[model samples]
Target: MPDIFFNFLACPLGSYCPLATLNRNTGICEPYSYQLPPGQPSHTCGGANIWSDVRSSSEVFCSAGSYCPTNTEKNHCSSGNYCPTGSTAEKRCFKLTSCNPNTASQNIHAYGAMLIAALATLLLIIYNCSDQIITVRERRLARSREAAAKVVKEKIQARARWKTAKEAAKKHAVELQGQFSRKFSRKRNITVSDKVTVLNEEYTDTDGNSYPSHEHSTSLVSKKSQSASEVEEIGSSPLMKMINEIEEQTFDSSESFSLEIKERNLKTKKAKGKAIHTHSQIFKYAYAQLEREKAQQQQNNNLTFSGVISMATNTDYKKRLVIEIGFTDLTVTLKGKKKHLLRSVNGKIMPGRITSVMGPSGAGKTTLLSALAGKTVGCTISGSILINGKSEPIRSYRKIVGFVPQDDIVHGNLTVEENLWFSARCRLSADLQKQDKVLIVERVIDFLGLQSVRGSLVGTVEKRGISGGQRKRVNVGLELVMEPSLLFLDEPTSGLDSSSSQLLLRALRREALEGVNICMVVHQPR
Candidate 1:
């Protein structure tokens, strides 16, 4: 018998015979039966082709390379070529073919190339810019340090200059005091005969103007002496100039003290033009304006009320809000009950056409006017008010009414021009531009006879701080500056004597004739 080797065959088999059956029907082969390893095929059963051997004899097995003798018994691998291995010799399993290894390596090599290219670009950029970046950073730091140093130097220099200026001022003050003392002493020691000789001599003033006569000469001498006294009192250094400068420096000889004075005067004039009127009339006017504003606001809401009204322009006008014994019966009323203490029961209001509310005390005159002006404090009122021929609520009617109460509303610190200019500004009219404001101020000043006191501080007026009459006119003047269509005045002539009151009323009456509604509340009138 020939030596036999077994192949583990994996194929459909039926039942469980342990060994495969052999067929010795081939012409040149001798029968063989052997098992070399466990799980190996012992024999081939039969085959018309080469693969009918199976380890289990009960069923048929087939190899991939062979055709079944019967069509129903055909066998073949599904996915790949069948290959046998040492671990599975008698049987076969499918194996997938491999791709070229060189192609896979090429893909990995391409990824590495991209990464290297990016890294090289980044490194090159950094290498080229590093020095420039460092230089820019260093320059920025240097500039910062230089700026800080300069600021410190400037601060130190400013401090030094201030100290020097202060020292110089102190020294100058001492010199001025000495000069003043010596000059006074020398003048006192001069004999009467020597004074006469000096007066007889043709002496020129600092301005180079000759003295006109003996009396004029004496006056000039006195003026010169006063000027000298003023110089000493103020000190010799340019203290005045220093006062005006933002920083300290030496005074210029060509810079005249008179120029400084003129500048001061101009400043004072400008300031005066900006002052708010704080006189009795202004308060009265503000009160009236407040009432008018109140009425107008109410009207804006479609409510009905009444109040005092005043209006004026370049000409003087009067509008008075007065409450008298009979004013309660007028076409106006309060929304609530009246409280007598919080309200004036009796007073007169003279506004425009009714330019004078003249009545005795306790006449409910002021109360009536306050009621009309929408300012009856602590008082219950009931009635309708008519304005512009309409029975509008006082709150809605405020915009049209201008009121001046019976007190001085002139600001004590402001000049007359300042008062009017501020008055014009406060109204905030689109028409009241800078030029219009100046003209308005000028007109008001002239109208109220305030030109002389235009530059005078209201606080320093000699007699009663701007005569009661002038103060009253200013009260009215402030209101007229706005050119309100309606105006009110309360006790406008209260403190004025007969003539002043008459003049004030006459001015108001004249304005009334020109179609400006004028009203005044006067306790007494000439």
Candidate 2:
């Protein structure tokens, strides 16, 4: 709502203010109008310093009565008295009486005219202060509004935190429940099956001894051939026979239940394995499995993969900078969320060799590279990066570590040669003459094979200019002109074709051979 109207005595204190006024002025509270020039911030008075804008961090506090005095013209009260209406030399507010003592009959008429004048003056005072009064009300209300908004924002954040905690708790509970069920819960029940016929073997020749004592004739008892007498005897078995029957029935029930449980578990496992998986997710899971197999086969290989790659450039290069950088237990973590992005990563990059760090997506590849280059200052880094086996300070490390980001940050308008020349002049030593810088740029251009697109503009993505691969090479050349000892490239061939990527990798390999330690993050190796 627009705070165009002002209420009297609604400021910090309920006193007669030269500033505050009534919303609907009718011979009551007076409001002053003070028009501000364009582009000036409007200030509202809240009893000298009672209320202010929330963003107004710098609050000006004043001693008692330092700013505005009560009910004086300096205070802009218009009337000399604090009381709204009265009759004294100051109280005859705006009333004027005629000086006609001789005409006593017209005295009443003159007094009435004087009263009208005073009332008119009061109205004029209130009208003049409308702007100031409205401004003060708005400012005071703004303070309250901002406070309310802050509360709402905090509540929303708290609610979000609570919701996240709830989800985490639910997940933990479900995991615990599943673990307990697997570890402790009985998976199958033992129950008696339907009626089973007991087995019986009979040898009539052995019992009688008179039939045939020579070779006993074996005969199987047919259930139908048993007489009613035999059936009754089987039912009314001995105690031992009854016990055997009961034990057998119980054992059979338990075995059948165990078989049922095993079958159910197999079905469930097959269903879970049949669940759909995205390409990346499947790759991650399969990669974990492959890692297990590799661990088992760890003894097969005697050769070790070195974290450090030593490079000695071909003797042809005039200036060879040997930069050996090693990191021990490098770690990076998020501030507010306490999430560890890079955890205890250790590696080494020495001049004259290309050491590529390959990993799946979201493996902290970029974070690790940026941290080594000091580009990840926003994150909390806890590790020591040693240069040449010594603890080199960040300032010195930054000077030597040349990093090429995934995105090309070159000026789109400048030509390829011009870009390299300017970059050389900026990073090259001041002691080196202009010709020296030019020579460095020329040498970089010649080696990188960017001479074909030297004069051509490195135009915008849509505009005509050099090819994507050439532009990328120019970006590298811009850094190469600096003659940095250690170079870090982050996914340099990310958006390039297979051939372009190989060409880029080859150029880096050549640089490594020349003794510039090159470390790059590549999605895959050729």
Candidate 3:
């Protein structure tokens, strides 16, 4: 029955047909399990037939470098193509790939190289485009700043001219009024004396004072001449001459008049819409407002010594939060050693004041600041640090604390504005408005006198940039932009000239007015 079944049956592709004899004991085909016997002699093995692992035929299986479409057929791979054992079709080789006829596989080194080239090209394009974009943005910002500065200068000049003209006109009007009053009085006196002569009597005044006499008349004429000479002298003075010249030029020059008119129109537009969109416009608006405020303060005499004394004495002016740091018996000892970094340091830093820590080299000024700021490392601190007269860890208010190291720990690649802006964004309150943040950054830049160098790079040793003094101020500005409640500085004025140091101190003094608790280490007492 198995032979009859095998006579009509044929093996499919990937398999082979073979002759087999029946096994009488097991009732199965001989030399193979679960295979039926072939009835005809023509049915001989040509390829692999048995599919069972127990009776596999390696000699009849498909060979390498070739494939079998049928169990009894085989084909060679064509040129520029590759094929592995049992492949039904050849594969075309990749470009630059090595593939000979009847090859088993194509080399992939060319594909890897192409992939690497593509990736490198992509990276190069990205880098170049990014650099170009940054350069363009910086240029635009610089131009904007220059335009703003120019506008501010023009506005200030126009204001000064107007003020000078007003003052000169007022002086001239006063002189004319004085001369008119004197002439009228003289005529009236002469008329009264004529009337007295006609009546043949003398005019007497209260307290037995006589009427206008010859000596009085002569004195009055002399005073008139002197005042006229004084007026002539003032008109010939350099200041008056300059004022007159400026007025003449302003009125005579069409270009100057047109420019002034344009400025007025721009101001009117600004006031009507408040459409200050660009950086230059914003800067111009802000500066104009600031100037107006300054002028108002000057006119009001708000910055007088008496006003300052009153502001200092008034408790209501201290509205911001005050942080007072008082340390008693502060001692910092090195771990596992008896040596002390700071011994018995007793002092307090008050709010709304600048406390200077002064000492010679290695006198532990930095150490004391570090200890107060809670930045001491690898040391055992033993002391009572009181915050607002209460014992508390400095870390509790670390969010409001700022520490500036002696080293200029700033990004050399970043501009002064960028460094300060990054610090402000990261350190300021998360909910702060962008306008407020911009205001803070601009204020810091203006106070530090970094306006000129705001767009310039902070610079590295390899690439020279702003001066060392400006860089140092930028370093301080980083912390100032954060509006810290308690600020600590280490050698902030170290390497600064006298003028730069004074500027820095003035900025710090302004901060102190805002109730910031400031403590800094200074090498020079002056």
Candidate 4:
């Protein structure tokens, strides 16, 4: 009984064990299985501990046949290498002593108590550190989730912007079609040029007309300005009133009329007809336009025209700048600093071409562009600017000209799409619908290849944003959305890479091909 008590209290390396016993004679620990109660079958299990105790009867550790195994058979009573006490890892043989019935019971108890204290200390350490490890892992996972969500949001915004642009493009197409239909259905066609009067004058015989001797008035126009008072004075003149009352013939400088003289008229000899060099294409286009207009008027109650000019009216006249800008003896002197920017600078900016004013950084390239564009407000500008054979007035042609300065300013907080949309609204007429403005913005976005980042914020120096090249394009696009005929760009390729510069120049050339006279002040060779 004492042996059982001693074996139960002691364990391997003096650790406590309840299901094992120490064997005597030879040193080894073994399990003690409980025998079944009388009349109770072993197969019939009951409560959990009672079942485990019943199963222990069939197993023992380091016991062979009827004797305890040798140190060789049991693998150790070794020195220096300690046994592992882990629940599931491989365990090595441990140093052990022979067991006795009642000897050294107190020493076993003391070592067993120490083992329990060490195990409790290890468990306390693990419990304390677990919270810090869990917190760090959770923070890493949270950062990953936030990054993923940001990418998804950007993708969604890009898709929505693309959808809006597509819809606006479709609506603009329909609007253009309706405009063409209305414009073609006109009865008395209006002249392409405003404030023009045509009067074809021909003379009859001297006796037949009895007026100024003339076969035909070939002069395109008289120096007399057409005005309300001029028309009133011509109509209320005494000579005109007297001639109308007596001879039944009245003449006005601006009017065409005829009178008859009975068989007493003189004939004027015909002058040699000048060989008119009219290009067939231009004449054919003009004639075809007139014929189509007549047909549309006849068919649609004098409300529409047909195929434009001759081939087709593909050009949007308002959107096209067809001016041939010529400058003579242009000079700019800054009176504030008494600096001469340009001296006797003469140049011509032709239609469908790119004109560059190249010079060093401190040169007058920008000054010349400002002078020709009439953007030099405070500076002394002495130049004559002629647009398509007519002298352009500084006040009148200001709207027709678009200028993008070197330092292109933009709102940083707004997105790329918003920036462009606001620019379109600012320049387009109030009569333009919201959709029309969106369409213009979309066109500018596509032309500048900004569709990918259209939803991105235009960040500034203090914040993150697009690349420098893209921002430069946005600056140019703001002016482009206005669709002015004549466009001036100052250092458009500034802060751009080679490929981006190439693309920007290509867009400018494309605009020039569409009849916009482009003038650029570039420092680099463009």
Candidate 5:
């Protein structure tokens, strides 16, 4: 009988099985739920057994805050490690994780917090670096534009010099040619008369004796032919020779200069057909446009009134909306003091014209402008204001209106171009293209003669920058860049010299020619 052996299986390593019974149906142990009591066969069986898998309440696994490595062994979780219930081995905590002794699980909140802090720091660094990069790029572009503008100015000067030299040479040549013709004709006449006299004297004169007329005539003819040959050898007169030399030099220079200009223009046209990706190309286009405008202005200066009207009618420029402002019995009075600032003033500001309001100190010029612009405060205005020959509030067309104050209202810290650009960006139509906006700003800069100081700061009281006259122009430029249809200016030329005042007026005149209604007050006109 092989010793009649009987084998009893023990519990697994990770589970406890005391007081177990075999189930005949399932062929497995039943009620293997309690651990063996220490130092006794069976005491109270207080705690549940440790097991990898538990199916019923009686077969509960190990509790939390402890780990079980074997059926009969359990240990509290160690430091730097965490253990869940029924864990066979402790898990080491990750970096920045909190795992105290006897802890159930690792705490990874510190890692999450560190990750958030690092992300925030990275974002801040990116923001600052991006801003610095943008600033540096803008500064480089500004320097490039200024250099290009300087080159354009030099080219303009060269063209002017060439034109002047050409004109002077032409005038001097004409004068010299006239003088040489007169001198040569006088010499020829004297020689011809002497020959005729010698030939015609065949008979004796009143006091002449019998003489050899043929011999005298032959000798005189020989002398006359010799003098004529001598005159022919002399070529042109000395003055005429100098004039010819100068004309040749000037003509050659002018031709070369013209050729250069033509080549540049061709290059510009070619560049225009393609995309302008460089600052130099952009400035070249601007220079070409400026040259065209100069030519147009010269033509306009020589045009009669009818010719100007016809030319203006034939231009391709899109007409802006006309704004004609008329006021009837306009009266403004102080609210509290009952003092009349404007007493029943009547006037109309028409499109395509400049209306100047001149008065001494204490006059109501500024007050009237403010009232017309619908910016009057603390005053009672009683009148009817008409817009486009209809009774409409001036504020209705505020978007198309502009008003320049007596004082220069401009940003002191920003450059002149920057100031104008800001105004144009804010006030120009949202649908306008970026190139068009740039053109408007540049046009204002050129018209106001602010190119030299475009990049210079407007300056504050603390730090001086451009002159007062330049600042005044910049102030007006702010409004001009917006392409307003109705403009009101208060003392725009007050602090400027005669030339600056004339320049401002000329710019305004150009605006007026574009169908803008302009009304300005001036203390003194130049």
Candidate 6:
């Protein structure tokens, strides 16, 4: 008991245990676990009643016979061991006398208690310091967030102010430019030169009339003036003075010969074949040239399209399915089960032949075409389309095929040649041989009989509007320029007249005979 009591009550050398402490100020005992080892028969069997701290359960030292410290069985006291308070050295530790505390033992216990109290105080100080540091970090983060928000708000305001300033400046600049333009126009009136009138003299009207009666009557006038702020309100520029002098001399000379000039003009304008030209005639002739050039350009572009297709067909002489279109167990269902647009449908297309998918207004003919173009078409398609003996999911084969849509895809403002040039540049790969592009474009123009309207606009012109057939040809031409083996046309003759439609189909047949695969959808055809 004495050995166990001392072991439970005493403190380790380097560290103090809170549970085994004795308050030096209060002189109180703190209950703690005192451990025994298995090496010695009894806990207090050693000669000096000493136990190694390394063999004990915890570092706490306590008196013997109290709650023993827990550890592996090997560390417990053995049954036979030497006793400290025994008559012979052979007696075991369990036979030893119990420890009885006295005033001296209590004093030592109080000293250990003071050391433990000091350690606790130090731990509390460290905890306080860490909490303070965390608090400071939190405050800094809050301040940083506030500063960042302020910066973002300021930036937003700056951007808004900049945008407002830019808009105001743009409006002011446009107004200033408009004012400048009006002032400039007022300073310079329309001037007609003799060269303009001479160019117009060659053209004759439908009635075979040579020119208008007032072709030569109009004359140029010159004025001399000064601004309200400049030149003392009297002086004009020297050039203005010279023009004014010439106008005066011309006006005086015209008065003497006015009657003769009028009669001669009347006779010349009325003549069946007059050689003289007027201002209006010059304008008409220039406009005609512009129209003719436009028509020729369109024709040239059409030839380009046809020529390339012919060349591609000649190169690839195989008759295969460039595009195979079908739908198996296909269905398009709306949000609710209320309506279904397309049901399970199937179709196929082969090269060197035309396969027509016929149906009424809402028969999904166009929808199937769109599906073949490698689009979802807002439907579920179970089957696949095969290309060149391989099941090419529709999306994969779209690269090789060419598609011409129903509507005329064109920029009405641009001339015919401009359209073809843009298409060639956009669609043709940069690495394509240049000679091929030239030959293909030229051949297309000649094949489509577009030489006459090669330079014409696709839309209505002043004296001549392009025929519906020609516009359709250009539409077809745009696609043919790419030289795809498989071609798909949607509603090729939907809104065209019989004659125009026939001409277009004939062109398609001619292209097919030349070994180009053609496929098109038509409303009604013989």
For each candidate in turn, give its C-alpha RMSD to the true structure in angstroms.
29.7, 30.8, 11.7, 30.5, 10.4, 29.2
Per-model TM against the reference: 0.35, 0.39, 0.62, 0.40, 0.62, 0.37
Model 1: residues with Cα > 4 Å off, grouped in runs: 1-352, 460-465
Candidate 5's TM-score: 0.62
Candidate 1, residues 1-526, lDDT tens digits: the string is 2113223333333211223344335322222243234354553443222223344331333333332433234333222223211111122332223223111111245556778999999999999999699668756644543454455456657987987877677577557656756866675556444566665664544236755467866776786687667656655447444443422333542456326534644654564466444233222323333333334345434523321222223122223232222233343334464334223233333333555666678766666667777786545665445554456666664655678877778787776766777888887476543544544554456445665666565664554456556777787888878765567788777677776666566556545544556565665654
The 10 consecutive residues of candidate 3 with the worst lDDT sum are 45-54
Candidate 5 worst ten-residue window by lDDT: 1-10
Lowest-scoring 10 consecutive residues by lDDT in candidate 6? 82-91
Q: Against the unseen true structure, what C-alpha lDDT does each candidate score?
A: 0.52, 0.58, 0.75, 0.57, 0.78, 0.52
Give a tens-digit lDDT track for model 5, residues 88-114: 678889987889988878899998899
Q: Quote the positional error of residue 468 for candidate 5 in Å.
A: 2.8
> For candidate 2, lDDT tens digit of each residue in 136-175?
8756644543454455456657987986875565556556
The residue ranges of model 5 lying beyond 4 angstroms of the native Cα positions read 1-77, 82-91, 96-98, 102-135, 150-274, 333-340
Summarize candidate 4's per-residue lDDT along 309-427 as a digit string, tens digits: 32134332225647788888888988899778888887788877888878777787887887877778667977677778788665576666889999857678887877887878778
Best by lDDT: 5
Model 5 residue 465 CA deviation in Å: 3.5
Indicate whether candidate 2 or candidate 4 has the larger lDDT.
2
Off by over 4 Å in 6: 1-339, 460-465, 513-517
